[model samples]
Target: MTSQHEKNTGEFLGATHLEGCLFTGEWKPRTLTAPVMEPATGDQLALIALADPDQVAQSAQSASIIQKQWAATSPAARADILAKAVEVLAEQTSEVAQWLIREGGGAHMKANFEIAVTIKALRLAAALPEQAQGLVLPSVEGQTSFARRKPRGLIGIISPFNFPLYLAMRAVAPALALGNGVILKPDPRTAICGGHVIARIFELAGLPKGLLHVLPGGGEVGEALCSDPHIAMIQFTGSTGAGRAVGQLAGRHLKKVSLELGGKNPLIVLDDADIEAAAANAAWGAYLHQGQICMATGRILVHESIARAFTDRLAEKARAIKVGNPVSEEIFNGPLINQRQADHARSIVDETLSQGGILEAGGSGEGLFYQPTVLSGVRPGMRAFDEEVFGPVAVVTTFRTEDEAVTLANMTDYGLSASVFSKDIARAMRIGDCLHVGLLHINEQTVGDDVVNPFGGVGASGNGATIGGPANLDEFTEWQWVTQRDVPTAYPI
Candidate 1:
C-alpha cells in the first residue's frame, strides 16, 4: 500500500519542475545546483540552482531599475494585482501546501494553515496605500509644509525554512503593495515553495516583470544581497546568530534592516486558571510545527499550587501526540527539519536531566523524530530553560508569587513573546503588561498571530521594527517632506 507521504511526493513531483531559479521575469538554471531532500524519508525531492554573488548583484540592480516604473503605477492598480495574486494562491493552495509539507517537514494542518494565513496577509497588504496616511504640519505664514511616504527603491528579503511561504509574504506582499521592488532569497531547504511557487504565482497574476525576483541559495548569496548597493533595505527572519550578522553588515552600510529572530518565550499559568485548558494551550504552543516556530513557548511558568496538576495534564497531552510523517493527517508532531536539529533537541533534554530537571514524559524517538517531551523542576540555569530548544520540548518551572513568575519569565536573553493565563481577566492583563515582550496574550497561547497585528520582537528577538499590520508599509518606505512658499525669503545676516 502506498503511504500518504509517498502519494504527496508523487503529486508534487508530477505537478512542478524540480529545477530553476527566477530572475527578472525569466526562469533559468545556474552553474551550481543543490539537492533538496524530503526530511521525513530522506528522499531527494529536487535540485535547486544556487544563486552566486554576481547573480544576486544582478538581481538587485534589476529590482532597483524596475522600482521606478512600479512606483509610478497607481496604488489601486497595484492592489488589484495583489488581489489577483491572492486568487491565484487560493487556486494553487493544495499543491503549494503539499510542497511545504514535503520540503519543510511540517504537518498537513500546519501547511494548510500557513497558506490561509499568507493569503490573509496579502489581503491586508493590499490596503497599504490607503493605510499609509500622510500629515500636514503647521508652517509660517505664506508657507505650506506636508509629509508623505515614498517607496524605498528596492528591498532584499531573507526568509527561513519554517513557515516559508507565510514569512516570505510578510515582507514580499507589503513591499510590492507599497510600490517597491523586492529580491527574495529563500532558504535552500525550502526553495520550491518559497522561491519557485511564489515566482510562478506572481507571474500568472500579471505582476510586472522585474518587480519581484526569487534567488535560492545559502548564506553567501544572502550576504551578497545585504551588501549590494542597489538594495535599499534588508528584511530577515531566522536565528539570532544569523540575524546579528545580517544586522551588523547592514549597519556598516547604513542600510535599514528588520529582523525577526529566535525566541524562548514563556507561558505563565496562575493557580486560578483552568488546568485542562491551560495544559492544552501550552501543549499547542510548544509542540506545534514540532516547536520550530520563532514564537514557540519554551518555558511554562506555573504557580506552585497548581504546578503538579498542570504538569500532569500537559504531559498526558504531549504523550497523546503521534510523531511520524507530516503528510499524514493523523500525525501531530512530525520530524524536525533535519537530523542535526533532532540531535540538538535530544542534547538539550539530556542536559536538562543531568542538571536535575525531571522528565515527566517522552524523552526520545527514532531518526529525525524527537517525541514530544515534558520536563519539570527546571531552573533558570538549566540549558532547556536558558536556550531555545527548537523541537517538541517544553520545560516547566514553579513560581510562588507574581513577582517570581515575572522574574522567571524575563530571565532569558529573549523577549519575543509571552502569555499569561488566569481566571481573573484583570490580573492576567496586569501580569501581561509587566512581561517584557513584543507580543503578549492574556488567557491565550503564545503561538497565535494575526495578519493585521504588528508582529515582531524586542531585545534579542529583533531590532524594534514591526512587520505585518500597517507598520509593514513603513518598513519598506521613507518619508518625504515637501514645503512651498509664495515668495523667496531673504538670508539672515
Candidate 2:
C-alpha cells in the first residue's frame, strides 16, 4: 500500500482534474483530460480532456463483443470479484473520502457516511449474485418450465456529484452482479474520488478488463454514453432536465433507461407530530451536504395550527448547524460542489424571497454556505415550492387539512421522496399511501433510504431504480423462455 502522501503526490492536492478509466472486460487505464474545480473555494482540482469519442465507441464495441463471454462466467465467479472489489474499497475508504471532500465539499462525517453506504452497497451486490434464483413450474403433461434471470448487455451508468460514491455503486453493482458489462460515467465535478476508487478497486480485485470502465467527462461524454448503440441500458442519477434529455437520447436508440432524477421532497408536520424530533430531522435532512442531495427534504409543510411553532423551532435548529470545511469533523454543512451550484442555490433563495416569502432564519454565509435558510409564506408558484432547491435552503408552508398536506406534498413535479411527521401511525400510513412518491417516511424526515427497498420516483422525478430492491433486480436481468420435450412426434400420418 502506498503512503497517503505518495498516492496523491503527482495529482493536484486541490487541483485534480477529470480522468477516465476504460476497462475492457479486464482492468486497464485510459485517459481523457478535462479541468474540474473545488466548490469550497475556487481552486483548480485538475484539467481533463474529453475521452476520444471514437475510443468511447470502441470501448462500447469491445464490451458488446465480450459481454456474452463475461456473462457466461459463473455467478459465483462474478460474486467473488464483487466481494474482492468491496475489500479493496474498504482499504481505500480514507483516501476516497479525502477526494470526495476536495471535489464535492461534503462535510467529513457526511463524506464518511457516504463511503460507508457505498461499502455496504458493494457487499450487498456481491452477495446478490449467489442468491439469484429461478422459480420452477409444476409439471404439466410430463413437462415443466422455470423462470430464470440473466444479465442484460452492456449497461451505461451515469451518476451525479452529490453522494458520488454511493449513487454510482447503487446503479453499477446490480448490473455487475447480474453479469452485465458496465461503462460508468461519474459526475464531472466529483469524478476523481469515485472514478479513481472504482478503477483501483476493480484493479485490485483483478476483474476482467472489459467488465467495468469508468469514463469521466462532462455532459458531452455522458450524452455520448447514453446514445451509444452498443450500450443496452442506461442507469442515470442527475437533475430532471438532464434525465429527460438522456431518456430521449436513449429512447431514440431503443435502449432501456433508469433515471433517478431531481427532488423537491417534502415533509408534512401534522399537528400530532413530535416538534423537537421533526425539527432536528428536518434540519439535518435539509442542510446536510449543504442540501445538495436530490432526496433532501427541501420543503416543510406543517399543519397551520402548529406551523408557527414548527417554523420557529426549525429555524433555530437550522441556524445552529455548524458550517466549515468538508474535512472538518465539527462541521455539519459545507460548500456546494462548485460556484455554479452555489449561484443557482442563491438564485432560488433570492427568487423565493422576492416572491412574497419571508426569510425565517439563516439566509447567507461565506463561500457556498447558505446558512441553512428557512423560508415561510412560500406559495405554489414560487420556485422554492415548485423547483428542487439543491442547497441549504428549506421552504415552510402551512396546510389546513390532511388532504391539503397530501396535495401540497404532491404539488411539485418531483415524486422522489416525502415524509409525514405524525405520531399517529394510522394517519401516517394513510397519508403515505396518498402521497405520490417513491419512498415515504413516518415520523421521520424524507431522507430515509433502504438498500433492500426500491428507491426511485414517478412523474418528473425520472424513472427506474437506483437502489435495486427485490423487484429492482429485474432491471439488470432479462427474461429467457425455454421449452423441452422428451417425446418426438411422427412427421406424417
Candidate 3:
C-alpha cells in the first residue's frame, strides 16, 4: 500500500490512480483504469486499471494450464495452504476492515462481521479437501464402478458490493481448496476488499501462480469471464437482472452457474410473540448494513393484535440507531453502497408514504446516508411492500391471521429467507413451513448467515443452488464415474 493509498487526503475523489489491473502471481498493469469511490463520502479511494478482454484471456489461459498442477497436489497440501490463508487474513483484520468501511461504505460492525465470516469460511474450506470422497456403485460380476469428484478447470466469481469480502471468499476459498483456478471480477466499486485483499491473502499463503487472478470491473469484464473458453463455471452474487444476464451468457457458453440473486425476504411477528424482542430483531434485520443485504428483512408482517405495539417499538429502535461516517465503530447505520442506492431507498419510502402508508420513524436523508426508515401500514400493493428495497428501510404490514401472513410473505416472486416469531415453537415452525424460503428461523431474524450452512434461495432470489457446506464440493467440482474390469470382456455378437 502506497502513501496515496493509505491517506484519506485529496480533493474528495481526486486524480489518484494506480496502474495495476490484473493480480496473478503479481500486479499486472493495463492502460484502462477505473476509479474506486467511497460510497459514504463519494471520495476516491484509488483509480486502478480495469482488465480488458485480451489481458483477462491471457491470464485465463495460463490459469487453466496451471490448474492441473494445483489439482495434482496432495489434499493435505491444499488444506494446509487454505489453513495458512486463514492466519494471513486474520492478521490483517483491522486493515481489511478499513478497506471495507472506507471504500465499500460498511460500518464498523458490518466490516468486522464480514471479515469474521470470511475467516470462518476459509477455515471451513480448508476442511473441504479431505471431506471430498468418491462413492462405489454396485457393478456386474467382473466390473467395478465408482464416482470421483474433479475440480472444474476454472471458476469466475462476480461478487456484489455489499459484503464483498465474505461473499467472494465464500466462493474463492472453496474453489481453490477443491483445486480449481479462479478469476474474480468484483464490482469495481469494491475492488480492494473483494479483489485485492483476497489476492494478498492467497499470495501470502503460497498459492501457485495463476491459480487465482483478480480482475475488477463492470459488465464487460463479467461477460468476458462468462464467455471465456477456460472458465468452466461462474459464481455470481448481485441483482436478479444482472444475474439473469450472467445466467444467460453462462448458459449460452454451456458453463455451470451459481446464481445468488436479490431477495425480498420477510420476517413475521405473531401476536403470541414477545413484542419488544421481535421488534428488536426486526430493527436489526432491516437496518444492519443499511439493509444492503440479500437476507435483510424486506417486509415485516405483524399480527393486527400487536401491530400497534410492534410498530411503536420498531420506530423507536430505528431512530435510536447511529448513522454517519463508517470510519468510527460507533456508527450503527452507515451509508448505502452509492447515491443510486440511497436514492432508491428514499424513493421506496416516499412512494409508500404517498400511497397511504405511514412513515413511523424516518423518511428523509441527504446524500448516501439515508435514515433508518420504518414504514408502517404498508400493504402488498405499495412499492415498499412489494419490491426489494436494498437499503435501511423497513416496511411493516399487519396481518389479520396466520394464513394472511403466510400469503403476504409468499406473495413475492423472490423467496430467499423468512422468519416466524411466536411463543410456541411448533406453531412458529408450522408458519415457517408455509412460507417459501431457503432459510428459516423461529426465534431469529432474517439477516444473519454463517459459513457452515448451505446458503442460497429459490425463485428470483436464486436458482436453488447453494454456496456453503457440502454444496461447495458440488459447486466447485464435477463428478465423473469410472468403470473397470480385471480383464477384457467377451465381444458382443
Candidate 4:
C-alpha cells in the first residue's frame, strides 16, 4: 500500500481559498494562512486560512444579502445549475474519491462509492423544486386557504468527517434546491474533500458569488455560524455533545436547526435468524468504514440460543477483513481518521476488558489501526456496550426473549437506526414496529441509505431530515399560508 506521501500518477487536487475566499460570479480565488493536514499521516495537505469567526459572520452576511436575489431567479434556472454541478461531480468522480480517501480515511472504493451516491442525491434534490407542492386546506367560513413553501433565506450547514461527500452534499443540494443560500462549516478534518469540491462546483456552475460559501474551520467557526442572525437555519451532523452545543447556539439566535447526532445502534438477531447471513450482515454493519458511522451497529443483541454461534462467525469474519492504508483497493478496513480516534476507540475497548468483558477476536494493531474487535459478556453498565464506539469494535450480548432484545435496543439515548435478522416475515414486521429507532431494517444490516427515505433520527438526534427525502426538502423551505375571501366586511361595535 502506498503511504500518504507517496505520489501517484493521478492528478493531485489541492485545497483552495480558505481566508480571502473564492468569488463565484467574479471568478477569483485568494490565499489564506489556514493549513489542512492528512489525518492518516498528519502530513500538511494544504495551507488553509484559520478563518476568524468574523469570516463566518461575513459569509452569513454576504449569503443573506444575496439570498433574496438568488431566490428570485427562476427555480428551473436553479435546477439547471444543480444539474450542471451533478454533471461535474460525475465527470470528476475519481478525483473526488482521492480527496475523500486522503481526508476521510476511507479506502478508494468506499470513497468512490460515496462520491457516486452524493451525485445521485444531488440529482434527486435538484429535481425536487419542480415537483415541490404545497397543501390546500378546506375552505373555512367561505374563505379559501392554501399554503406555499418559500425559501428560508440563508442556511448554515455543519458536516461531519465520517461522510465527507454524502452528509455535506445531502444538505447542500436540498438547501440550494429550495432556493436557500448556504454557508457550509464542515469538520476541519475532512473539510477539503467535500468543502473544497462543492465550493469549486458552485463557482463553476456560475452560482451567485457568496450564495454557497465554504467556511472550512472548527467548532468556534460553527458556533459563530449558528449564532449569526443572518442565518435562518442550521443543519449539523456531528457528535451528540457538539450537536447540543450547536442546538443551544441556534436556540439563542432563534434559528431553525437540524442535527444528526451520535448513535449506539443495535443489531438484534432472533433465535430463528439465519445464523450465517446474520453474521455476515453484522460484520458489514459493525466494521465498514471501521465502524466510524453514526448508524453503525455497535451493539449486538443475539438470541441466547444462537449467540455463541453468531459470535464465533462474526469473530472469524472480523479477523479475516484486510486492514491497511486507505488507498489500497484490496483493503477492507482502513486506519482510523487520526490517532485521537484510534486512542479513543482503544480506551473504550480497554475499559470494557478491564470491566470484565471478553475480547472475542481482533484487538489493536499497527498505527491508527484498531482491529475489528468483538466483546462478549458485556454488561449494561460497561461503557463499551452503552456508549458510541466510533471505531471497529462490536459488543455482543444475548437476550432471552424478543422483549429483552427490544428493551436493550431502546435503552440508549440515541434512536438513529436499528436492524433485525429473522426469517419470519410476521416476526420481522412486529420487531420493526416495536423498534424505537428512526430507521429500522429487516433481515438486513442498518447501514443502508436511500435518497428518497426521510433519513434522520428521533429523540436527541435533533429535528429535520436530509437527502431527497420528502421531509428533507420541506425543511429547507418556509411555509406561507394564503387566505382569500370574497365580500369581506368588518364592523366595530
Alpha-carbon error at 150 in model 3, in Å?
0.7
lDDT of candidate 3 over 1-493, digit per residue (tens): 4466535432211123233556877776677787778777777777776887776798799999899999999999999999999999888887788788898887887888899999999999999889846899999989999999999889999999889899999999999999999999988888878888888889888999788998887788899999999999999999999999999999999999999999998999988999999999999899888899999999999999999988999999998988898886479887888878878888878888999999889888889888888898888789998899999998899999889999999999998999999999999999999888888888899986777888889999988757998789889999999999999799997
The TM-score between candidate 2 and the true structure equals: 0.93
The better-scoring model by lDDT among 2 and 3 is 3
lDDT order of candidates, top first = 1, 3, 4, 2
Q: What residue pairs clash in candidate 3, if any at all?
A: 33-49
Where in model 3 is the C-alpha error above 4 Å? 6-19
lDDT of 4 at 326: 77
> Can you list the residue pairs that collide in candidate 4?
34-47, 34-48, 34-49, 34-50, 35-48
The local distance difference test score of model 4 is 0.81
User: Distance from true position, residue 232, model 1, in Å?
Assistant: 0.8
Candidate 4 lDDT over residue span 189-263, tens digit each: 776776777877677666778788877777788889887889999988899999999999899899988888888
lDDT of each: 0.87, 0.79, 0.87, 0.81
- Report the C-alpha lDDT of model 2 over 328-384, residue by residue, as the tens digit: 556888887766777888888888899999999987766666678999999899988
Query: lDDT tens digits, residues 81-114, model 1?
Result: 8998899889888888878888899988998999
In candidate 2, which residue ranges exceed 4 Å CA deviation? 1-32, 464-466, 489-493
Better-scoring candidate (lDDT), 1 or 4: 1
